[model samples]
Target: MNILTAMSSRLTVPFLDLKSQYRQHQAAFDGAMGAVIAEAAFAGGPWVERFEAEFAAYCGTTYAVGVANGTVALWMVLLAMGIGPGDEVITVPSSFIATAEAISFCGAKPVFVDIQEADCNMDPGLLKAAISSRTKAIIPVHLFGHPANMEAILAIAQEHGLPVVEDAAQAHGARYDGKMAGSMGLAGCFSFHPVKNLGAFGEAGAVITNDGELAQKLQRLRDHGQFEKYQHEVIGWNGRMDGLQAAVLSTKLPFLEERNAQRRQRAGWYFEQLGGIPDLVLPASLPEVEHAWHQFPVRIPCRDAVFAAMQGAGIGCSIHYPVPIHRQKAYHFLGLPEGSFPVAERCSREFLSLPIFPELTEEQVRTVTRVLKLWITRNHRVKNIAFSGKLAV
Candidate 1:
């Protein structure tokens, strides 16, 4: 019997255990939901307003507008900023498609840029060349809870007279140079999907901004552009966040900091255990930034084989993205070829997201590392033996 087969019977770890998180604060969640039910505020009402205020304060922003989901959060921000046909938005291709989709949906072109090899975030050096005469805005995504190089990105934006909207979907409490991820830009967008750090029971999202006029415009844009009942001021969509999701998010917000700390702790354990592996490349963090550790993705040789081996050992592993957005069929019109963004394309092929969550225990982490190490060791030995055989022949 192999190491993987033997370990499979003794241990099993999931990528995320939301049920355990729910059980940790069941009463608070239930009571909050019950209150919303009692008031019958099923749509946008007091609960949604309460969460918006609390979230804004937490992000150190003057205002936050609740919306249906993170995609729409980005979409709404672009719309409110007057981004439309003939405009262009600059962002990296090493992110979820939603980042670029939001721009495409707004009738603007998404100009792709490569990311830094070390941190897998946007490379500020490349940002300047991508800006064109039609460039209207910049959307810097805080990918995998690691804040991007905002100081440099912002300086360039200011020089070009452009607005920046932070994509903080996976970086709820991440900080950069003592500033919150979403607070540094003109407006920051967030998502409250069940898997996020501060998630609701279902889809929810918000935009935080220091500009009050922008806040009011977002509020109107989310609700049919209504200035008053039966009074439509501008064309809009049904993007309002439901009251139930808002209540659930509010209940989960207070505990987000604690959970983020736990995630960091888990990340440290991964570094301590896997750092010495010669062929493994661990995730990198920038100086003066606090990473939220949303996903601990590491690059390794023979990633597909190792991933399958880990699965056989009862460990839940995933790939954040196996394909870059530029290569996707949906974006074929962009005319970007295979090597447009080499770093992102390489990462998409080799990156593996191991099991990581607040509820994951130290022992579980140990099991995961052990399985990975065993696979690497065995694969190396087999390759060496084959090389020797070839020499003898």
Candidate 2:
């Protein structure tokens, strides 16, 4: 059968392949989880400590604080940095709103900056223009598993005496210039959302840093501000990562590098297959960075039409962010116009994420690419017919 007929025979192909991942690691995962349950160490216990240490070592950092989730991870980092009311944090507009929401939750303003068209990470060139005396820190997101331009961002932060925080929620096991994403800044935040490269059964997250003092502060911050029981010293939040999630994460940690490697291989196939398609822009890999491929998003002209075509063809495809954060209703007070952040706005319209989990087969990759190319060609034909007297595609 042709690619379209083959896809149409199926009902729904998932955008992610979580079940395959779990099946591959079931024995070890079950044993670790059982151990956590048997110990009855549900919160802030030995398992949590063990996972924190292991994750810290994995990230090449001195300390890692397990938290409730990625959002809390960002919140705890911002709080630890002493960012508060009237302060502003600079970040890109192309991220999950959690990056901006974390700043707003801390009673600080999230100053929006545009992104580089290449990787959708923050454009460091625009960062300098956005900084003010109230700018307390820079939270650069490693969007879609690609590392931000950290070297330039780090240099700018160091020159201005600003602390750099990494929003590494989607970039587990991703590295920049031989250093891991979470270790590239003063503090790096990670998420164990089930969809990420290194995921937990449920919600979980952590903060990693080389600064010992900051590490202790985050520990206190997550646990009611008390190093000891019932001695509340400062305002804090209940953001501790449960031992159960820690156990799951620990079981999954050792395989992170291998899984990310598989993802890269899959991404390579997608690029190789679809890179030359007309009006389609494949994500670029930079020389200094290793992509985790948490998402293998492609930018195509008339993205919505292509999305509808893929869905009609029974291939699951989705957009990473249909609306840029700055343009969202919650952030409308920023009063940014339609073309305010051109790169981010354009990207939101054009980018669509494809199925790229490690477990996906080469056949599946070919299937997706074939469907996408066919759809794009058909759409181009329709456009040409409507505009000109001749048929095209």
Candidate 3:
């Protein structure tokens, strides 16, 4: 059958169907919440402690400190490490604003470096140039659930005697050369926002590390820097993770591996169906790493037109980011020009995130690809006709 004929029966594919995920395991969620309510453990208590231990073990780390959100997790880690004013943290500009916000909130400057086109991550080769005498740390984000080049980044950080704080918010089950996403850095920060691979029902985050001292300091930082009740040791904020979010996370933790596998399988299906379309760029994964496939972002010309077409076809699509952080109004004080980070800038303009979730079926994927292919064909035909008209004139 022709492509259009095959897709005549349309399916409405959501960008993320959280309701389906919840319905699949409603009983466990209800039970977990009930236990917390019965014990009156609403704040940071046994439930939070239980989840911290479980998550730490899962990440192969000695300590994990739960916090209010992923941005707080990153902020608390920097605060614990004493990254204050005049200090600069090197990171790429192609991540969520939270990554840079965490550093800026800690009274430090966030230095931006361009990303590598292949992985859309921090280019380790550009690391040295961005580092200055004030550079104290590095925060490499595992953007879109693909782990960054941790080995090279770590080597560079070690040479400079700076610590590495991995922004692993999107990469729960991702791995690089057999090492878990959050385990290779000095400290790894994660977000359990509702849309993440391993999400809590509400806002939650955590920091995992092997250093016992850093862990203790982080624990204190999240709880108003208190060693004991009513005794404040250092200036801190109310960053503690609530027991309800912790309970939700604990209940969902066991199924994360299976869900991640399902996402990977769906990603494979996209690769099979969307390969070799002219002028389309597919995301690339290094052979040494296992991606968690948090967001399947593809690059194509006339992205806005295609995005609108996809939406009209009832296929939910979105943009990972339409503006690079360096060009954001909040960062204008940094004085970065339009082309400061070309790779990230180009990616911002062209990247389109298709529907990708654990519950997305193979048939839904086929439908999305079919609609995308039809748009490409139409776009090319328009360009060809315009070119031919110009030649005849």
lDDT of each: 0.91, 0.89, 0.91
Number of clashing pairs per prediction, in order: 0, 0, 0
Off by more than 4 A, model 3: 1-9, 384-393
* Candidate 3 accuracy as lDDT: 0.91
Report the lDDT tens digits of candidate 1 across residue range 1-393. Answer: 666767789879998898987798899889999999999998899999999999999999999999999999999999999999999999989899999999999999999889998689999999999999999999999999999999999999999999999999999999999899999999999999998888889999999999999998999999999969879999988899999999999888898999999999999999999987878999997787999999999998667777877887799999878899899999999999999999999999889999889999999999899888877777776754532111111
Error of 3 at 89 (Å): 0.5
Candidate 3 clashes between residue pairs 3 or more apart in a chain or in different chains: none
Candidate 1 regions with alpha-carbon error over 4 angstroms: 384-393
Instruction: Quote the RMSD, in angstroms, for model 1.
Output: 3.0
- Per-residue lDDT tens digits for candidate 3, residues 1-393, read 333333434658889988887798899999999999999999899999999999999999999999999999999999999999999999889999999999999899999989999899999999999999999999999999999999899999999999999999999989999888999989999999999999988999999999999999999998988979999999888999999999999999999999999999999999999999998999979998899999999998778877866776678999989999999999999999999999999999999999899889999999899889877776686764532111111
**Per-residue lDDT of candidate 2, residues 1-393 (tens digit):** 334545677745678878887798789888998998999999889999999999999999999999999999998899888999999999989999999999999999999899998788999999899999999999999999999999999999998999999999999989999999989899999999999999999999999999999999999999999999999999887899999999989888999999999999999999789867778989978999999999988998778867876776678898989999999999999888899899999999999999989888898888888888877676675764432211222
Which candidate number has the best TM-score?
1
The segments of candidate 2 whose C-alpha lies over 4 angstroms from its true place after superposition are 1-7, 10-12, 385-393
Sort the candidates on TM-score, descending order.
1, 2, 3
